[model samples]
Target: MAGGRIADQVGRVLGGRYRLVAPIGTGGSAHVYVADDTTLRRRVAVKVLQPALALDQAFLKRFRAESQAAAALNHPNIMRVFDWGEDAEGPFLVMEFLEGGSLRDMLDSGRRLTVSQAVLVGLEAARALDYAHRRGLVHRDIKPANICFDDEGRSAIADFGLARALAEAAWTEPDGVLLGTARYAAPEAAQGRNVDGKADVYALGWVLLEAVTGDAPPVADTTVATLMARANQPIVAPFGV
Candidate 1:
């Protein structure tokens, strides 16, 4: 089935619980939707595994296992996973709904945030990464789009779909499919190698650089070969007022 049609079908209720409201965003492996949890009587975010991924037994197993691992991590700065289960359609994860929107939106708005505001965002993200790192999880995807801000201005790291426990196999080889955003992916991740907390730190640095300068740092390539080549290169100073 075509992806769009599959997405449309999944838009209907699954397991008689979550009612998909609308698609919030799409990542490399899944589509996130704003959903209403009938059982709990509140809104939540539902991430539906992509049709291609859902059909792959190996990938589906890893997806569910990794998501379960991520669920064990609970922090104020991390989005909470309420549940995970499979339906006739596919696998899905129910997560806390955040209203404000993604950091990517803020950056694209062309609003120049004060250094203090930017720093606060960075701090919250750093804290979240620290917590995850301590728990032995590495958030392979930490770009602005995955960092969400609530109405109260609190930053929460939203997507752990690409996150992997430190002990797990880092990537699905033979495909050479990189799992994260090109611009913000760490050198190790870009190279399709195992990554640790330092990768998250590098991605966070890119986010901070973007927030301060209103532009993402240039990348030589989305691959690890290119990333490793320029990983240690110094960043340019922020634009002066």
Candidate 2:
């Protein structure tokens, strides 16, 4: 995904204030950078859309979804978005920088959290979701990759990119659309139906299950018919918590 010097964009300055320091991570459509906000004199995470994604009208719409939803939220467990604007590279969303890395890292290390630790993480993340849900937002994506930690190892939910509001719920585009990560998605979501707070709660159950089991959920090939059919199916858990 990184081109020659494009990979070396660490020293570049964006929007005349944010200076890129290093690459932090990447998503389906953006590369995240830890940048110094020269104007504010603090470090921030910058999520810049890839050139290919920036050029797609559809991706731009989804990008705007996260920016708008996150900008409206002000909860402690939810990642805070400070500012967003386009630079020469592409459109970027500026957010607070958290150093504790992601929950995916924790899970991948093969070290399971104690029962109490896992409970605490689940509580904090659930609070974040409850806060947003009360305000009519459904965070469609809730896999490990989107759950990060704070300096004290507290769980925080990031990347509300697939979040959809209840009133104007647009579950699908003109063509068929499955808005979230298939493995964690609620059945209604895969069927392109309006999902409520229940969908997020369901996803959290999967997150916690993986935390204790060290197993990734299996994903069947996602097709319109199959995805919708999953709605009528019952999921059998491998083990009891």
lDDT of each: 0.73, 0.74
Residue by residue across 1-241, what tens digits does model 1's lDDT show? 3457545864588668999988887654557889999998999988776444455666667767777877888899998888887765557789889998888888888865578988888888889989988888878877888888778988899767544522243333221234236567765665668788998899898888787778776656444544665455555645772
Candidate 2 residue pairs in clash (backbone atoms < 3 Å): none
Best by lDDT: 2
* Residues 74-178 of candidate 2: C-alpha lDDT, one tens digit per residue: 888888888877766767889888899887888878876677877888999899999988887668778787888879886778876543421133223312223
RMSD of 1: 3.8
| Clashes per candidate (backbone, < 3 Å) | 2, 0
Q: What are the runs in model 1 whose C-alpha is more than 4 Å off?
A: 1-11, 165-180, 220-241
Looking at model 1, the pairs that clash are 190-224, 191-224
